[model samples]
Target chain A: MKMEALVHLVSAIYVVSVLLGTHGPVYGRLVSVNDKPDPKNAAATARWLVSQNSWGVLNTISSELGGAPFGNVVSFSDGEPGKGSGIPYFYLTTLDPTARNALKDHRASLTISEYPIGTCGKVDPENPTCAKITLTGKLKVANGGPKEEIFAKNALFSKHPEMKDWPKDHNFEFFKLDIEDIFLIDWFGGPKPLTVDQYLQAKL
Target chain B: MKMEALVHLVSAIYVVSVLLGTHGPVYGRLVSVNDKPDPKNAAATARWLVSQNSWGVLNTISSELGGAPFGNVVSFSDGEPGKGSGIPYFYLTTLDPTARNALKDHRASLTISEYPIGTCGKVDPENPTCAKITLTGKLKVANGGPKEEIFAKNALFSKHPEMKDWPKDHNFEFFKLDIEDIFLIDWFGGPKPLTVDQYLQAKL
Candidate 1:
């Protein structure tokens, strides 16, 4: 009887931990399963995304706690399709006091798109096409703490060696966009989109 | 005769000063002119490019020198279409040592593209469009300069009032991508491209 009681206590602890963990209410939005993305199209899109460099808009926004605002750029991955570990993701980093405060206070939305004239590869000038996506989610600083922070930091450093020597104490925080909804305008056709849940459930 | 010689000497000094003070190479690569851009397609492309909000990719270069070698979603504008100033432009306010150093050592290249998946809005998901434009230009610290710097500071501040109180001594530099060339697919079909010179010359 004591062993069973202990087992029940342990199960309760596990449930409570999950409820209060990083992936709890902060990630409350539900994502529907995505249809199997077309392989050829997905590969092409992934290639184009990964082949380029540079992203971000320099802007200032009001802080959540109220005060002076700050300026920063939100970034993301173009996800290399067919590349198992290359799923696309978005992030927010700022030195702006207001933006940082707001990020900590509420969910943020990120809109992504291509430069009008193109910046990395050959954009078909005559049939020039562009894409835009909006991701709504919350931001959570991912530096320090357990293995997750270490892994994220290493991954960011490996991809951006130039930032290897950035000052350590500066409030340089990295936050991941736990994407909830993804709305896209595939100029080739419809305006349908895939949710994060659908995306995760789809067999890529 | 003395007066003439003095005039000539003064003229020589003026020319020398102008030449030395210019920030770019004395002789830029001559670009060939091309036919007018197809109006219908150009407008379509322009609209598409303008509608994008975010993107992701790796910027594998120095940020201080100007190689913002990281992936971040940047806000950009399509400058007035015909005039060079009206072309698409990206604004970056970075204090990264590497990017700053790179900007000082070499002109920067900005590569950007749409993310893959149905989410980030790829034009032809199957042929994800992208572009690479080399901003081979100079960097200017936007402070305590002559009329141009003052005007620029005011203009930028007005556009971004939130940054009015940022430290004035920060290495606040404006890096302009005097776009030398653009490689784009899906713009003019898939084969041909529009060079910066061509676009400028064909400007309506």
Candidate 2:
């Protein structure tokens, strides 16, 4: 092989690495299943989505746009990878509208997809078989005791080490979704009917 | 290089290539920039975000949540990759809450992040250095005539070819965000000041 051709091949290999190797599994929460969950196993599937994803879209009532529903890309953690508590937690600041909106109206939702986990194979992201989840309920600031705070901090910091060093002036605080409803679509039958209790009690 | 080591290295390269080799260029919209857009070029940066990203969280007022803001994972197109019109378009159906929500209320926002673009490198997704854009405005069904439908259909089908074969029973139709305000954070100074006119008029 010519030296120039070899260099081009090496560069192509490196770019591919950058694209595919970027899903940071700071913890072992990401599960690579050979197949998606059965449509009937709604709770287990919902739990899997929440635990595996490091970030999701947090929704809130936009106080600025005459009460428009606002969504923002935010990093979150449910637990320490496989040991998730089935509750999504976030580190947020009021500088962003999401946190501010949540404070005024706790009604919110968190949406996540299985595509980024790399287990969906060749299917398009919108495919029903690929799986998508939305946890809808109240978004509340964590007023839990020191133990709860520690849990939230450790879960978030494990997946996102950079969070610990975010600007102190931003007044970043821990928040959790007080989920009242769960909408999980893992197969062809539309959203699997799931309850909050089943989700929290499921053993993944 | 020893033959044994070379074989392993070659295999690793092949796997990485398979992982990153998926996003085909419908156009040159997928700019793998060596560096991010300068914060000063607000319109250019915002347009770049819309064109480069194939998916984002589409937000709308949730009629079920009693007028709360809702966000859903969605795939979208601005144009054929690089040929984007600075206007985000989506193929949606009433089977999904996003399209249903929009039908009830047009106020919405589309949020995209630079983390997925692979340009942020080692920077965390939540880090300020990583760019995130929120295009706030009305999410309207495109009834601009058959010309608009053809444009949207072509643009979307080019990126997500599977959409062309999505279930006809789902009744998917074209929807576009009539952008009113832009909030983009590419640097530490906070959301850059950008206008709708500036975003659509910027020369990419």
Candidate 3:
């Protein structure tokens, strides 16, 4: 190989090694630091949090616990890794309270933290600079027809490869939060003034 | 140093390096794998999750959003590292929605995931085997007295050193989740059959 090509090859290997080294053990995909939007950009940052994270706390009003807010750790996908739609989709089973509760009362929220993305560095997870977004809306089955189901499956299975082999009897189906409100805290002031339309329309 | 002592020193360094290599960037503390309780021990597992995790999604019925379940990422501590009290505590300010919501209606839950502890390995975060816990109950201020506040401050600041320096004008105060119910999923069957009493009594 030419000297220039050899240097490029070594640099490529170094980059790949760093990515793998820092990748969340469960989320074995790349979350490029370069792709992260600036904290000042509310809409873009919100979209980035939803798009980059593999799992978040999916909250629903519990039927079992007297309508108390119930939050469960869940894996979600907006789209294939980089091509996210900013609308988080979840694979849930009715056996779990989150799904059953959503079925009865669709009021729910999906909270994603930038802390897990490794970009927060030494910042405390609760620190405003770390960034967190909560998309509050109705959680319901993705009954958008066979086309949407196929898209949901592809989106989930692409990022979480293990989901494709999960027990068939569990009856895991795609559910999504129909975002009505967006609460993002990327900087010190407080929740950013972002709209659902702004979040979905942000270029990720 | 003696040759045997030198060998021991090198081994210790190797172990420390491995531990730091896997520590979450935001949670700059050690969570030993050996300290993890057995999956079959419901109460023990619940306490372990509460103790080991430095942060979780604190859910509240949003007062602003017309009672939608709002989940926000927040840092918490049950006690100092390896000495947890089974009940999680937080340093929150009413300036944020979660604390404000909690003040209006105390019903809340704190959802914690074992994935961030770096113990789940290659298992998908949503998988039951990865372990997740939701402590549901009232979220109220720690008005147990000055003694309790001191304990809360120590529990928080020890794990999250930076929290001690967070803006004092924000009026951050100690808040504890008065766990009325424990929903723990450490293994495949379903939510563990563990009660609040069983969880609090478990030796950590």
Compare the candidates by lDDT and give the number of the best one. Answer: 3
lDDT against true structure, model 3: 0.85
Q: Write the per-residue lDDT of candidate 1 for residues A1-204, one digit (tens) a residue.
A: 354554454445434443444121211112211322333353333223332322332122233312111222333333322232223232333443324544544343344444321331232211113444334444446544676555555544444433445455545555555544443433444333455665444433
Better of 2 and 3 by lDDT: 3
What are the lDDT figures for the candidates, one per model?
A: 0.34, 0.79, 0.85
DockQ of each: 0.02, 0.42, 0.43
lDDT of 1: 0.34
> Candidate 2: TM-score?
0.87
- Sort by DockQ, best first: what order? 3, 2, 1
lDDT of 2 by residue, A1-204 (tens): 454565467555444444454435344323446434665788887888888887778888888867877788888999876688889999999989889999999999888877766577667777787778888889998889899999999889988888888889999999999998777888886788888998999988
Model 2 residue B199 distance off true place after TM-score fit, in angstroms: 0.8
Error of 2 at A10 (Å): 13
How do these models rank on lDDT, best leading?
A: 3, 2, 1
TM-score of chain A of 2: 0.85
lDDT of 1 at A118: 36
